[model samples]
Target: VKTTVSVIKADIGSFPGHSRTHPKILEVAARRLKEVEGSILIDSYVTHCGDDLELIMTHTKGEDNEEIHKLAWDIFMECAGLAKEMKLYGAGQDLLGDAFSGNVKGMGPGVAEMEFEERGSDPILIFMADKTEPGAWNYFLYKIFADPFSTSGLVIDPSLHDGFTFEVHDVIEKRKILFNTPEESYSLLAYIGAPSRYVIKYVWKRDGTIGASTSTQRLNLMAGRYVGKDDPVMVIRAQSGFPAVGEVIDPFRTPILVAGWMRGSHHGPFMPVGVADANCTAFDGPPRVICLGFQVCNGKLIGPADMFDDPAFNRVRDQCCDLSSVLRAHGPFEPHRLSLEEMEYTTLPGVEKQFKDRWEDLPE
Candidate 1:
């Protein structure tokens, strides 16, 4: 058996406050996917992460197929139109590039796909994130594949004792050169810790087994302009030879901080929340992530175990809620405000323009 899972996401609209998407808009997207089912998908699901709408599709069309990508794009565009009708906020917001071109790669959305030979039992996890860049997965990936404390498989399971290798990418570079983890763990960590410029593209076990993969592509890098915020998406294959679901999910439980929110301009903890949860409070977010569990067979989707609903996660959410309140109180001050580096890609340019004269006299 073979399985192909494609996870693509776009920000069609957000409420007037730029916090959530209109329910009707999501329904329109569902309707469009239903219309294209026979032509494009085997089994599909639609859901939101913050203000973005994500289309989780199972198909044999392979990655980046125009017929498939366009189907999702058209649905989002239609949803965007509906958002406009309701006068929703940020309608058609993240559709940065003028044309969709061959695919949405750098146009504004985040895309991650995996095609592999199916196991006796197939399991995959879909991750949708709001308020963070592709690099948010840095720590999670490191924990799942590198740390034995988190992934006991390394110490207890012989099949996983050998650490995994990661292909790290320098997203800022035009030419993509990848460096590996384990052997180059320190070097990889040094680069990925920067987050904004480096991202984890894929990971494979020491014995050559693929552990995970993510679409490290960033839109602002390609567009040369910050059209809108980057709402990233991810997919990870769990169990069997890879890390167990527990390991993959362990890192998120900590809701450790990352950069993103209200225009992709700040750092905050990546809260793990359930389906239907709204965006962050105050200046937009403490950043959030949603996980969907699934099993695939013969190139189709099976289960999406809305992981956040489990009783164990309930405690984590409580912690997140408390953290949000504390952080919100800080408002625009240090530690709460996005660091100056992360602010560069956002509206800070406009702020910079206001003080452009400050540098005039010191320069030629």
Candidate 2:
């Protein structure tokens, strides 16, 4: 059966500050999805990564289906209302518009979805991140799909030898391009290396089977202001012709630096953590990512095993802490803080305006 897996997320509200999601918000989302589970959805799971509430659902409806989008929007609206009653921080912050349109793409929430025929024993991984942007997934996706060293299957396994194709999006230009890997891998890097602009939206196998999909919505760009980080989500189908679960997740062990930390302006290590530890605390985050493994059978989601909740990842967590300290020490300096061009959507422009009059031309 052709099943569509949709992972939609938004920061409707959180407790105290933008550190963690309120339990009540999650409860409301769960109850709301349950109401239409058997009718509209085949399966549903509601969870959170830091302040963002993620709704993972399976259905027969294809990508960007109006009914699926509306269901998610209505749930977020109800949750936002409850959040306001509880006086939660940033309540309804991501619901950019007053009313739900036919879709939620530009409305504020981050959506990553794909529809595919279910393979026998189809294993998939859902990655939800908080305190980061859609570009944050670029590094790992490259390593998983292109780099042979990162994924030995690319070199060893015959099924993966032919390589994959990446569907990259230029978020600023609102354009997309495809590059077949192992061949145009160099060309692909030239764009995706600059994550803030070019993001890998989807990856497909040589046979045209879908390998992965990521939410490429840039919230600041959509709202035309510094609302918050995009806090993206991704779905990667594992095993069979795709990379094994281990190969797909192995890249994150390095703890690479990504934009969106405190004030959504600083660069910090992207730390992998379990759902239980997926909250922003230090410096509003060293931006956290959580992976949940699932098996899709007959359009139903089963076994969301917390992939990163292992002792093996403890060393990387420590490395992230160390890196965070080093970066934070920079304190508003470049390489730690984003460049002026990237901060255009942020409040940096306003700060520059304040000092505009006092500034004089420096030594020519």
CA lDDT, candidate 1, residue 3: 55
Candidate 2 worst ten-residue window by lDDT: 355-364
**Model 1 ranges with Cα > 4 A deviation:** 177-181, 206-209, 358-364
RMSD of each: 2.5, 1.0
Q: List the residue pairs that clash in candidate 1.
A: none
Query: Total clashes, candidate 2?
Result: 0
Query: Candidate 1 residues 144-261, lDDT tens each?
Result: 8877778888789887766677777877774444555456667777877877788887787676555677867676666666755566777888888888887888777785777776
**Over 4 Å off in model 2, which ranges?**
362-364
Q: Which candidate number would show the highest lDDT if scored against the true structure?
A: 2
lDDT per residue (tens digit) for residues 73-151 in model 2: 9999999999999999999989999788799999999999999999879999999999889999999999999999899
The estimated TM-scores of all candidates read 0.91, 0.98
